[model samples]
Target: MSLHAEPEIRPVPPRPAYDGTSPFPRTAPLLRTPGARWQLAATAVIVAFPFLAVVLAGWVLWGNVLGPVDVVLAVVFYVLTGLGITVGFHRLLTHRSFTAAPALRLLLGVAGSMSFQGDVIGWVATHRRHHAFTDRPGDPHSPFRYGTGVRGQFRGLVHAHVGWLFAGDSSPADRYAPDLLADRSTRALARAFPALCVISLALPFAIGWAIGGTLHDALTALLWAGLVRVALLQHVTWSVNSLCHMIGERPFRTRRHDRATNLWPLALLSFGESWHNLHHAEPTCARHGVDRGQLDPTAAAIRLFERLGWATDVHWPDPRRLDGRRQ
Candidate 1:
């Protein structure tokens, strides 16, 4: 009989420690609620109104009855609302490119409301989604989604410019914007979007009636300040999605698939958002136009806020970081 040898026991390795990081954490599934569809429909109506007004203005202008007051109202409202979206919504809210004092935050929220581009929360959620899935399947508005061919590109451009908003898929705010969702004040303002819309449309008429003392003045102001201004701002904001992606210089390198560009014509109107190539490369940076001679009004506003002690924690672009991203 052979003597049986005891089987050798191998020592087990110690279990890895839990460092509390996750590549893909558990997320709540997206909800396809009816409210989202209604909200989208409302958005479409608001976006379309400006275009309709523009056509009306062209007709009136050709008829040679448009007034100087109309021009003044349109110019004034356009600048106010445009700056609100760029300085308030994009720079201050979405990117936190800089911090703002509570009073400044409230004022910005109100000013942006005057733009009538939905409330701050919805805008931020949609924008964050755009960045998260830019030019990809989940992107809210990607001009390249349809394809690269001419016809496909044409269709994609339209989709990116404004068609995507009509689509009935609301981005889950919880998944993308927990910071905003957690803020009680912001949520309250967002829920008051319908009220904001009412005020946005009414304020111009009120101002015109008060200034000019006529129903004609009120109607004209409504058309010029409310409708025309909204349309111009909409296109400028949308162009960052369509034109900025389709044209301009790309000095900074980005993730291979991201297709942002710097189209200069849009620089002033978009409040320096046309420095899109740099924006896509460094989204959290307060200044999109980091290069010398690239004028950025939004950055200047943030700087002013900082100087006044109203803002802090600004994510200014570092030269070293720019060097790393240079093409």
Candidate 2:
């Protein structure tokens, strides 16, 4: 045969068939099979109860018993728990935006646990999944999932806000949160989530009782600082998944379907997480509020930690790099 002539073609190497199996070992689904209808109903009731109480308090006790103390407590608790998630769970754990000392790591982990959103590993897994398949079918919560019409947007907003949590599907921790899973201390903390939840609820009551020295005061604090605080935090967090995706300025470009935005109104309440467009564009930057006027309490906290030597390798935004990301 001439040198240029093709040799008898060897049987083409069998293409590696996906066969629908992931390269990594499969994990048991995080959520159990659909629970009894009553279980779901109970969850709904529990979630709704806090909001109902907030409404009732506003209606019945706004000026009488709900005073400055209640307002201050609400703001304090909200800031602490909000940062626990934004700084601890989302930035540090999920995105590795900064490095923290062991003490700060443990503190942040515990603080995030007190938020009672979910266990650390579970939260990280769900959030990672959110980024991996943002606004797509596999996304855990996406305001665009249902459709683009008015009615569809309404349904999608609600679903993204809270309904997705009730869905039977769950992000696989092994696939999305291997780093947290490998950390023995964090894994242990995740396993103790139930106890942490109890402590989260009771700590407010205890603090109120200690400060006010009355059952009524304690009860009010529990209502405002505990339940209402949690409800407000939950809604704010959900807004990033729902409202942030639906409205505001997308200053930075991201993955085609990642509809993150900068909803300025939510900045302070969400500890600067409302700068979602920048977040998606630069996932590992510690500061989501990259612009000059953006207010980022979480970034402030991270800066303080760095100053205190509790955090290192902080990834503050670079103007040049951010300029390139801008739309």
Candidate 3:
């Protein structure tokens, strides 16, 4: 495919006029449809399940303590799948930070699905909408949506952290991610999400079972390496929307009201995603951690891929462009 221009993504317009005669089309500020209840229930399960797994691994179950092998499995999965999100879902798919070879794109998409973060299309659509709106009203996960003040900020944090997901504020794929929506490969991946989810959890259990040949080993791996790892990564990713926006230093300037900030502590774990300030300022730049001493494994991985002839046209940071954004 040819290198294409970044499609302009405009924020959702302010409330369109509606006549009282019939319900006009509009995005819901809060989920109100009957399906909203089911979505809320699913969100509750997703948010609570990992915490439960962690507690069980640490204390609740007698056989739950993870062995060294389990720890290794967890770490490996965390790195691979986390990069799947940061490099594949966020940078390559959402921002088109680089052009990936067909085989590389397929591998990245599948690896990203194994993280259980959602399918590629939905993930790209949601993230593109986020870049389009940042901390503004239409942003599905803005930490400032609830307004100002201690109480409001607290509410905003909660909303951005996880509550916005239950609000059913899904960005339409056609609207925000038409390029991905139009792709045959991506559409196939989106259709495979359910099967991929089962594989995400089951693959670790299979590994543990093969290595240890015991039910206890398999169960332990399923909990710690599977559920616990996914849960931990999920919160780290969500923190970019919640904690990064609310706390970290904004050393880079962005469009007005873009509250993205750089939270250094999460740099390694979030795979450079915590350099939120730089990200919002230059969304398509492949490297988020531009400054010296900033560890960005994702950017390094992209470079490695480029060297191997798997990724091309990577938008490496330009000093002049970045200097302009520095504040």
Q: Model 3, 110-169: lDDT tens per residue?
A: 889888777788888888888876776567887776666677688889989988877777
Give the distance in Å from residue 243's predicted Cα in candidate 2 to where it truly belongs.
Answer: 0.2
Q: Following a full C-alpha superposition, what root-mean-square deviation does model 3 have from the true structure?
A: 4.7
Model 1 over residues 1-327: C-alpha lDDT tens digits?
111221122232343432222111222425357776677678878887778887777766774676777788878777777777887888778877777899888778877877877888878878887886667556678787676778778888998898877766576677666777889998988888778777877988898888889997888888888888888888889999999988899999987568899998989888899999999898878889988889888888888889999988888888888998999
On TM-score, the stronger of 2 and 3 is 3
What lDDT score goes with residue 11 in model 3? 54
Which stretches of candidate 3 lie above 4 Å from their native place?
A: 1-4, 10-40, 60-65
Among all candidates shown, the one with the greatest lDDT: 3
Model 3 whole-model lDDT (C-alpha atoms):
0.83
TM-score per model over all chains: 0.86, 0.86, 0.91
Answer with 1 or 3, whichever has the higher lDDT.
3
lDDT of 1 at 128: 80
Off by over 4 Å in 1: 1-33, 62-66
By the TM-score metric, which is better: model 1 or model 3? 3
lDDT comparison, 2 vs 3, better candidate = 3
Q: Rate residue 151 of model 3 by lDDT.
A: 71
